[model samples]
Target: WTILRTRLGWSRQRPARRAVERDEDAIVAWRENEWPRIKK
Candidate 1:
């Protein structure tokens, strides 16, 4: 376990909630531009 953790850089934390290929810029644009319009 120690060898795997150290040598292979493994972690015990939970996986990320977001997608690996998620578009951050698009999400930001939607939040800043579209979401406000929709919320109103």
Candidate 2:
């Protein structure tokens, strides 16, 4: 952690995540079927 914060100049941040169950197929469906609509 010190190396990351000092040498690399990285700081802690809120991690992004999605549902553990929605990883592969369900996620693909959301991107194809729902995400585009939401983007518009």
Candidate 3:
């Protein structure tokens, strides 16, 4: 269990949640930009 914990600690340094949030923001921004254009 100690070895597993140590390995997990080292492997979990990246910001996964931030990456997902960024992707969601980008998709929202894209949809917002497209909505007005589609009406014309």
Candidate 4:
């Protein structure tokens, strides 16, 4: 793995996988509305 990454410059990081039952709408709302409030 180290040799492949060093020689080939291949990334070992995997893509994030969301749950099948994840709420897209709620996540969007939280990011848009709630995140700004908490960020301050």
Which numbered prediction scores highest in TM-score against the true structure? 4
Expressed as tens digits, the lDDT of each residue in 1-40 for candidate 3 is 6687697664435654555435776788878998789888
lDDT of 2 by residue, 1-40 (tens): 9998999999998859766666698778999999999999
Worst 10 residues of 3 by lDDT: 12-21
Clashes of 3: 0
lDDT of each: 0.91, 0.87, 0.70, 0.93
Q: Residue-wise lDDT of candidate 1 within 3-30, one digit each (tens)?
A: 9999999977886597889999999999
Pairwise TM-score winner, candidates 1 and 4:
4
Name the top lDDT candidate: 4
Per-residue accuracy of model 4 over 1-40 as CA lDDT, tens digit each: 9999999999888659968999999999999999999999
TM-score versus the correct structure, for each prediction: 0.51, 0.45, 0.32, 0.53
Q: Deviation in angstroms for 26 in model 2? A: 0.1
Clashing pairs in 4: none
Q: Rank the candidates by TM-score, best first.
A: 4, 1, 2, 3
Q: Which stretches of candidate 1 lie over 4 Å from their true place?
A: 1-16
lDDT of 4 at 24: 96
Pitting candidate 3 against candidate 4, the one with the higher TM-score is 4
lDDT, candidate 4, equals 0.93
What's model 3's lDDT at 35?
72
